[model samples]
Target: MRKLVIAISMLALAASAAFADPILDRQALMKERGKIVGGISKVVKDEEPFDAAAVLTQLQALQANAEKFDADALFPSGSDTGDTTAAPKIWEDMAGFKAVEDKYLADIKAATAAAPADVDTLKTQFGAIASNCGTCHQTYRVKKG
Candidate 1:
């Protein structure tokens, strides 16, 4: 009985960790993206000195995350609860949502390749990337107060 209890307890813990809420997962991912972009934005806004190398590194990280972002897996069905900002339309119009996601990923890839050398170029390229994010949020993300 003692051994069986321990095995069940371990299994329960593993299952819970393995099935962590998808909403939380996406939220954390978005926060990371936001932090990276925010760092670049500060430089572009002249709030910080423009460092091409730093910008490139941050953009690379964003691109890496974008490349690995799998909405279908991360935004699983019935995960639009908790603190999720995902709208119901995501599950209803999955293809449309995916199209937007694809565009964002493409924009990130382009930005990574461009590696804007100065604030002006960074603004232009990063503007497109930011716009892509806004477009998706407008359609699929619920506003949070």
Candidate 2:
């Protein structure tokens, strides 16, 4: 009976660890970002000189996706991963991580809000958001070894 209990406890712990993986969450976030980008591109291509009204609605949808990409939530308490694209240092350097996250979120928020006036404006705003991806990738993302 004691052996069975130990085995059950170990299984529970392993399941919890699987549920707590940050790498899976990061992958999900990347997938979501791709979906949002696809949606935005579809809108852009369809709306030539750019239908401000339709594009604005699409931008709003993009913002909804952004809400899911919050760094705080991405790196939730107790979440860790051995194979994350995110560096382990992020956990130790909370202030630096938050600063970069704040910059990313703020920039994306503004861009989403400003994206719909015209095609040129949408391009500028989208570029602003893309720049953050590059910035964060350069600083925080670990290349696969």
* lDDT of each candidate versus the true structure: 0.88, 0.71
Name the TM-score of candidate 1: 0.87
Clashes of each: 0, 0
Writing each residue's lDDT as its tens digit, candidate 1 over 27-99 gives 7788898998899889878999999999999999999888768887789887877777789999999999999
Q: What is the Å distance of residue 137 in model 2 from its true position?
A: 0.7
Q: Lowest summed-lDDT stretch of 10 residues in model 2?
A: 41-50
Candidate 1 displacement at residue 100 in angstroms? 1.0
lDDT score at residue 25, model 1, on the 0-100 scale = 74
| Structural similarity to truth (TM-score) of each candidate | 0.87, 0.66
Deviation (Å) of 143 in candidate 2: 1.7
Candidate 2 RMSD to the real structure? 5.2
On residues 66-106, what C-alpha lDDT tens digit does candidate 2 reach at each position?
A: 66665676787555566567766677776777777677677
